[model samples]
Target chain A: MLCSDSDLPAPPQEALDALCLRGARLLSGPVWAAAEVALAAPVVEAVALQGGRIEVFLRTPAAPDEALCGVLEDSADLEAALNVLWSGIDAILPEDTARTADATRRGP
Target chain B: MGDLDRLNSKLAKLKGKDDGQIRASATDSIVSALLTEIEETILPREMILTNESGNRFVLVVAGRRLLALSGHGAEEEGSEGREDAAARIIAVFRGPFRTFLDNAREISIDAARPPNRIDPTMIGCSVETLTAALVGPGQASVADPVAAACDLAVAGLRLVGGDVVGRSGDAAHLARLEQFAGVGGAGLGQLAGDDTDAPCCVFLSDAGREDAILARIAFRGAAALILAPPEARAELIALCREPIPAAG
Candidate 1:
């Protein structure tokens, strides 16, 4: 359930819940979430959720000096935004032995 | 002498020297000459990014580094103004090229990090794809997809005298771009002969080394060469003034 009062609309609450769930799913895997994740892997540096809108701050290792922003109106738009973020992370992540091992264990 | 004439003479003089020596000499002369021209032609006001605090950051796109001013401020504290500021900044920078954000409010700015570096892929596409993604579907302003793509890629780069070369569809050539993964400028030379159909973009980092490097890649049919510091625009334009004869 989204961390909102009972008065909030269902669609927006559902969308926020989905976004958090997605973040949680990523955490369940090899990835971990923290402000420090910006130090290494691409991570969500900041997020703003309010009034049925979701905004994400993405810092990528490829260009550490910059952050990319993505906004989603509701749960319907969350997947596309997530896809953009994940694609960028994949682009920068090293394709080395350890990464390969982790990915292999994670499976498709 | 005319700019092209002077450049030709310089190239002629570099003919007999070692390949590295000639390239270094040519690059230096070109950069020196162009810096003067850039200052006189392009106004500084045109490049300034005017927002709230007037903070400047380095934006690197397609290998070119540009000084971008912060146009939005996270005023009012909390997250209320943060994402809006980021969206405004991105919209301002990308607006000139007709790129639009689907959900500007969904974007957030990581104020904790210095806003200098920009990874082109962060938007989930190559510089090329980002350009296309921003375009609204059924837009009548864009008639030719290939030309539009090339224009999009070049526009994304904050280059002064930069121009796209080779094929415009190169941006759509993803298989070729994959080869550049994890490789910086050092490993770029190895990509010379890999795929004839593949297209790539170039940006000159240093003055001395770039002449030879640019020449070599130009010979290999790279898509574009962006002169950095914006001061090198004059020289880069002159060096690339004539179409390089494709490698035999």
Candidate 2:
């Protein structure tokens, strides 16, 4: 979508990365897959796949605003979203990541 | 005459009941309605998800003040076809987000995304899962099924390494969603902004193993789901109280 809106400046990839470092969250999928639901990625202006990382350019919520999914102000909103989405869907990350998650699961 | 009529009739029968009886009935009626509305909005049927123990339950979202309710459904593996997938995808990514995806396709980033390719059965609980999880076992009250669900969700987060960190951090431009707390300032749904609709975005990020774990944890929260059996806390506690697994 950012490509079409070329007139408008794309938000820097660094901004979203900063949020990620600060633990800001973003969802990476196209909005259409509910059955394969992941958490909501905030204002996704652009997306790129450099090597392994899918560099998503997101518009940081500048003010108290309404999102289609979670509350805007909630920082942990992304984390919460991921929790719900991944309850069933699996291994969106590399297989190794999934193994790590499985490792953490306290088995009976 | 119908469902509401039947519900009303049931309520009428309880009119002369004792205070305790009336409160319990009222709580059940109101809470069930909240859960049912969300369920119908998401799932095509009253299908309930169960675990190895045969414990039957579902998840739903409870908003802050009020969050938007999405009626669309997400897609899964056994699809009818590409057309079916396209239709479902369109349904999920409505409004401004649709624009976001539309532009995204031009560069074909979706094709390049491998780490994001998901087995829906593993993540995205469908709409049936998310809001339902938020509706939780604790939405009704402090001692209701909604509270218990919330506790389970909290445990689920903890299981995935999502801990309650302090609100204040360094002088950074943004703080993680963990910093904010939800109702009663308890750190629930902190990022659940007073938004319009729910059942939002699908997750696809390529972070480290730890970030992946965190993402999965966030996906759990977004899905708002857990596999805890819904039981009465009071009676269960009196019966030696095998704790609700890892709840807060």
Q: Score the docking of each candidate (DockQ).
A: 0.01, 0.01
Per-candidate TM-scores read 0.18, 0.17
DockQ for candidate 2, please give it. Answer: 0.01
Tens-digit lDDT track of model 1 for B134-206? 3335432232222222333322211112232333223423222222221222232332222332222222222
Worst 10 residues of 2 chain B by lDDT: B105-114
lDDT by candidate, in order shown: 0.31, 0.27
Q: What's candidate 1's DockQ score?
A: 0.01
What is residue B194's positional error in candidate 1, in angstroms? 32
Q: Pick the candidate with the highest DockQ.
A: 2
Extract clashing residue pairs from model 1.
A55-B106, A65-B117, A70-B106, A70-B107, A71-B106, A71-B107, B51-B71
Candidate 1 wrongly placed segments (more than 4 Å): A11-17, A26-28, A31-42, A46-108, B1-248
- Tell me how far the alpha carbon of residue B152 in candidate 1 is from the true structure, in angstroms, after superposition: 7.8
**Chain A TM-score of each model, in the order shown?**
0.37, 0.29
